[model samples]
Target: MKIAIIGCGNMGLAFARAFLKFDLVKKEDFLLVEKGEDRMEKLSSFQPGVITGVIGPQIGTYDLIILSVKPQDFPSVQEALRAVITPNQVVLSIMAGVTIANIQTVLDHKAVIRAMPNTPAMLGMGITAYTASPEVDMTQLRKVENLINATGRSVFLEEEEQLNAVTALSGSGPAYFFYVVKAMIEAGKKMGFEESVAALLVKQTMLGSFHLINTADKSLDELIKAVASKGGTTEAALKQFEAGNLDETLIGGILAAQMRSKELSKG
Candidate 1:
């Protein structure tokens, strides 16, 4: 399919790289519209697609157009996009908190899909949740889903509102994972391990645990019980965590993020 990407930033480029890597779209069939001189120059090194500095009538020719611009930058590009966007063409947006209704209204076009993909998409290991307007047909939706899956995996939500929860859970999930890793590393340092050594230990443990979670035919509770043996070191740490209400705190923080996402969507 012919695809056009409006922004070439990290997430945008991540999609571009994944599409190319999976042979989903040929370099010739891809078009990149980026305004920054340095970014445009940098894009040349990768040569992912036909690069241009401005949105033009030619954009209407593509089968699918991806809007990956910042939420604040939508107004700057909307007018230009509206002028050339065709009704039959599908527009997929990855901008955080930008609703499908808003995109369809602003662009004066239908068949819009909005998706939330995290930073891990840059490494082709992300999980994305997406939703589409009623105007988007089954074929178009599936095609978009296939494209999104190139980054890792994707789930389609029936209601756009669910995306706010997804934003809090998986969208901001990597940072939470990093936060825990950092705390563990700090605790190791306090226990007399060097910073690098601590990082190595914690990272490897996390990695192995992740693989176990995926491969082992065990529930999360079962896995936890296996590690936190009765009155063991892991159990002691888990007890401290429970005393601190860490699980509740984490849930509260994610809920706060979801609330903020809703507020942004309203604007």
Candidate 2:
């Protein structure tokens, strides 16, 4: 199938690379659109035969269009696409707050799939949550799912509003993990390890912890209890976290992200 990707930014490039890596789309059948000349050059270097440019009359030739442009840039992209996008072409958007209805209104197209994916998609480990307009059938939805799954896992939502919660959780979740890892590395350094060694220690600890969580059948609270024996060092740290209300603060932050996501969609 002919596929066109607009923006060609980090997320776009990640998807492009994944598509090429998985042999999901031929290089000749792929189109990359980016306004920046430098980005076009980079894409050309990365995938030699893919076509790159702003949206034009030729856009109608593609069966699928993946919109990866920033939400702020949608107006300009929409205007450029107004004359070219046809009802038959499907649009799968990964812009954080751009809803399928918003895309439909802006581009005057019906088949739209809106998705939220995180930075981990660059490593093919991201989880994308998506919802589609009624105009998209199950066959088209499955195709979009396969394309998205090239980067990582994908889930479908019955209610579009749930995307706001997904945006708060997995969409911005990587940064939360990184924030804690940064603190852990600093704590290691304060305990007398070198900077590089501290980073290594914290990184491996995180990886091992994730592995344990994935492989074990125990619930998260049970796993925590397994490590935090009464009156032990783990318990001591747990007390500190509880005293600081860390859980409440984290939940509040995620809710704030969801609120911001809703506001962005409105804009």
Looking at model 2, residue 95 earns an lDDT score of: 88
Candidate 2 overall lDDT versus native: 0.90
The digit string of per-residue lDDT tens for model 1 on 1-267 reads: 999999989888999999999999988899999998999999999889899999999999999999998888888899999999988999999888889989988899989999999989988999999999999999999999999999998998999999999999999999999999999999999999999999999999999999999999999999999888797899899999999999999999999999989988998
lDDT score at residue 132, model 1, on the 0-100 scale? 92
* TM-scores for the candidates: 0.94, 0.96
Name model 1 segments beyond 4 Å from true. none
Q: Candidate 2, residues 59-84: lDDT per residue as tens digits?
A: 89998999999889888898889789
Model 1 earns a TM-score of: 0.94
The residue pairs in collision within model 2 are none
State which candidate has the highest TM-score: 2
Clashes of 2: 0
